[model samples]
Target chain A: MKKLISTPYLLWMAVFIIVPLIMVAYFAVTTADGAFTFDNLAAVSQYANIFVRSIYLAAIATVICLVIAYPLVMILARIDVSFQSTVLMIVMLPMWMNFLLRTYAWMTLLGNNGLINMLFGLFGLGPFRMLNTQGAVVLGMVYNYLPFMILPLYNVIVKIDKSVIDAAHDLGCNNAGTFVKVILPLSVPGVMSGITMVFVPAISTFIISRMLGGGSNLLIGDLIEMQFLGNSYNPNLGAAISLVLMVIILLIMTLLNQFDDDEDRVLM
Target chain B: MKKCLSKLYLALVMLFLYAPIFVLIVFSFNTTKSRSVMSGFTFDWYVKLFHNELILSSLWNTIIVAVIASLGATILGAAAAVGISGMKRLPKTIVMQGTNIPIMNPEIVTGVSLMLLFVFFMARMNLEMGFVTLIIAHITFDVPYVILNVIPRFRQMDPNLYEAAQDLGCNGVSAFFKVVLPEIMPGIISGFLMSFTFSLDDFVVSYFTSGTTQTLPITIYSMTRRKVSPEINALSTIIFLVVVAVLVINNVIERRNLRKRGVVR
Candidate 1:
């Protein structure tokens, strides 16, 4: 009976997730010339610039998300429970809408003649070239991924004991001291999760870079996308790039996990 | 003093977070070719949007995909959740972690990998990519989310109830139906809704798998790439409103349930 109930899920997983991932691993090894060579792995060095740019941009976006999310999460944590739920709902509501629509909306706001530039013009600041820049790419990424950062932070922050803060105060720690030494140290888990969540997606995101950054700022995701759609028709190269990107992501996550472990040990 | 400053900062952060959505909603009702400002209020864009055959057809396609995929995912996820709950500790942990891998992986990776699989399959079987492929891809991603949502509820459920039912001479199937199903219904409903929303909103996976028949997001993507249209804004605004309404309704139902159980004031 249990097996009967579990069969469908097991079948779906085997056919879809496991099989597709195995295919990715297979394709990553094969060359465009139909030869099974490690040449695809060598192609990684040629696209070094794109990999660096993706990491740099993702790092910037992750930092911005951390900064923005920290205060918002702190506020949400300190608020009444009902208000916290409402704020959480509001934060998550954007996720429910179409991601493409959200990205397009960013375009409408940041384009040359878009609303933000128009507003600047009205304020006598004149139009600034906000679109098709690394700044714009980061802005779009931070906007899209802010909630991912906030939710985890909020989850961790809300669980933090208020008595801990009070105890810090009792120990002659100033507000800043308490925040830095106590609250921040305790919130490392949230910070790590938020960073992982933001950095991973931001690094791999193609649409935001394409739409908002135009043809100027190229990320690894854009390069992979170009291989498939733009000019290069090499599925092997695309697979290779994806595999490299996957490794970089895995490395970052492992580093973050190590950091988290060290922090946990210190706290303990 | 610090608290006051933090509160002010929080308000500004909220403004930043909501500003783009607010702009989108405002522009949806604007009566102009440009999306810059509100010239005048009009329903023209909404009317025009409703008239677009491609948009309407894509919307219909999206609805069908989301419904079917959500239903499929919910069934699979619920069964998995139930099965996992009945498992011993080590196997349960293994299954739980295995299911979570898809969720943790990037959407692009999932999208491209699935596209490659479909391409490989098509080459082998000569089958075309369309509804069937899209449904398969959607189910792939959607089931994990449902499993994540359902597993906790299953864990939290009292096990003695099942034993009690069994001791009363009911067989395992009858015991589960009478005992376990009722208790896990809320989790199942929430999982279904989560899966439905996810399938409805997904673009990347659908974009890869959806051959010629575009989903609503793909349709909007093509339209926006061509030209900026207030009709897109109108559609987005309507979709946003629907999500908000659903969320509020869900909250209300949850609150009512809490009140019924005397868990809240």
Candidate 2:
């Protein structure tokens, strides 16, 4: 009876998610001519630097997101209820503007002869170039992905019982000690989720790196895109690379769900 | 002193976030084509945006796709959620994991795989990729979000409410609409809004499956490869103001809720 109601969505899921994944795996292990070979998967070894660099940069971005989001979330948690929505509105408003427009705006700001450098020129600082560098790319990543980190962290911190902190003070603990021992531990789920949310998109991102880092740097996303869109035009190779990325992401998401499992247990 | 420090830090972060938006809005009205130095103000770009048929049409396309995809996903997802909510543990797990697979997957993978599927499907059917494929791709990805939102509301509702409605002379369909729908309407609305946001904001998936149909993001992307135009800034400024307006309206509604609850006036 239930299956009858679920039939349409089940079919949609099967056609869209299941079949497409199987096709990717099949493409990964086969030659373009429908013959069996693992060369597509083998070819990913050549772009090992791009893969490693992608993960490394994503990690750096995630760490930066954590650092910046923590204090901000703490302050957001301390705000009054009526004012909280207004603050959150500001945080989210930038996100609503087109993503490409946001990235393009950073190009103007971080461009060699951009506004910031022009301001520096007035102070006799002589325009230190900030554009088309790893720092620019990281700046873009953190700027774009920071809100994902903040929202999760803010929700978790906001839910921490105020009385628990009071009890810690009564037990002769300082604010720093109370935060470290009581608040931070309680926020593990949020931290885990925040890290995963930021890391996944950061690692997978091609746009920020492309716009900010220029051609000198390439991430896995760029490589995958090149296989399909660039002169390479290798669907099999793209599938293979996507397969590997999918596995890494699947593992990361497993960790995310592990954090959610605690929330689930509490709800149950 | 600590409170002041925290406030100062918040101000700095806010500046970081809005700096680009500031540039986007300012450059829209610039008399010059420069990105950095804004020379003077003009309404020419906004006028050009209206006159540009391609941009206007794509804006229309983007909104239509978002609306249809969100509505379709909500219906399919809400039904699926109701069914899944009544399932055994193992089946429920399997279905849920299946639903979430798309949500959990990298967007590029989803985009590429769907592109490949449509290509293959079209080759077999001797058809082409266009509007239908794009909408299907959107709904495919969007359904998971809707299901995730609605299922929680289903769980939170009083389980026996449906039974009570049936006891008071209602059939299954009527009982569902009368008792269950109102309870979960908030979730469904939020789910629809989420789907709309994802559909509208998406670049990769739309880029892959669009097949020559331009959305606003694609139009903006192509613009980036060429000379940076001030019209983009005008379009962005308009979008920014619209979003801010929406949030302000949302805030007013929330404030009214607080007043009714005796928390604020």
Candidate 3:
């Protein structure tokens, strides 16, 4: 009876989730006439630079998130226990609003005649060209995904026993030493999860790049999006690109999951 | 001094996080469409937002999809979770891992993959990709979340509760409805809300599947793409307010429930 109840869901998953993915794989290797070919896969190599740029920009953003989030999470962990939830709520409140609007807010702030330049004009500085740059794209990623990094790190670090820190100190380790050896190693799971969370979204984001990067700085996402939705209109190429992206992400996640094995073992 | 510095750091991080939102909210009331320069304040944009047919229609679509998709996912996921809890090792692992695919996969991949499926099938069926496809895609991504949320509740539930109800003269269906349902009610509610929020905020998957139909995010995307407008700012302000209201109400209800359960003083 219990197994019977799950049949509908299993059927739904097969139809929607598994089958669709299979179709992506199927379409990727096929031409417009449905003839099997590797040309679609070969076509993806032309966008090699965009692939590199996506990974590069995503890495930078992930690093930036880690750098920014770690100290903030440490501070968050140290605060009064009673106040933590409220502060955490405040941290996540922006996510409740539309992310597109949040990214649009950056567009206004970074535009040549936008708020930042307006503020610069007050100091008699010439308007700097900040918008439509790779910097702006990375900024958007870091701005949007910082919370993803913070949440996981906070969850892991907060659960760490207070006496653990005392033990490091008693063992004659200084503050920096304690952080490097004790806190850092202990926070590995959080760090790994945080990196995965931020990196995946940052890499996959098309909206942030399109809104902020203008015409010049296309990422892998933009390339894939163009093949289908944009003026380019090539589903075969799009499916090939999507398949490669899935494999890349899968590879990265497999690596991350390997790192998370210790945590999984503990849970089990 | 150290404590003070930590607090200052916290404040600055908070500032970085909120500055964009603050700017958005403030500019919503600006009289002009100019994104950079702020003129005198007016409620004109807010008023105009009501008259905008495209935005209004998209908002309606978003709400409808979220409601229906979440409802479907919750029911499907809760039932699957119950079933999975009774399964043996190999099948359980296979099903659970399958459940994680949507959750773990990038939204773009999920969106395009489903688009391929729908387009292929719809072409054969001679159906257009629009509302029905959008709902299916939403539910597809949403079910994993519901399953994840609900499965934990099943683990926490006493296994004998159904038997106890049956011993009290209830049949299998009645026992489940009376006892097991209440035990997992909180999980089901949370799963529903999570699915709803995900569906509401979703843009990427909806973009691929919706065809000509527009959800709020897709509408916002196109609006932003075409040009900057104060009306978008107005919409953002409204959305922000609505989100705040819902979250606050949810929090209050959660606290009240905890109090009733004597989990909190």
* A186: Cα error in model 3, Å: 2.3
At residue B63, candidate 2 shows an lDDT of 95
Off by over 4 Å in 2: A252-268, B261-265
Interface CA RMSD of each prediction in angstroms = 1.9, 1.1, 0.9
**Global lDDT scores for all candidate models:** 0.84, 0.86, 0.90
Stretch of 10 with least lDDT, candidate 3 chain A:
A259-268
- On the 0 to 100 scale, the lDDT of residue A102 in model 1 is 82
lDDT of 2 by residue, B163-230 (tens): 99999999988998999999999888888988998999889888888888888888888888687788
lDDT tens digits by residue: candidate 3, B117-235: 98888899899999999999999999998998888898899998889999999999989999998999889998998999999999999999999999999999999988778898889
Which candidate should be chosen as best, given DockQ against the real structure? 3
List the TM-score for candidate 1's chain B. Answer: 0.92
**TM-score for model 1?**
0.94
Q: Which lDDT tens digits does candidate 2 get at residues A240-263?
A: 999999888778678667646455
Docking class of 1: medium
Cα error, residue B63 of model 2, in Å, equals: 1.1
Chain B alone vs. reference chain B, TM-score for every model: 0.92, 0.96, 0.96
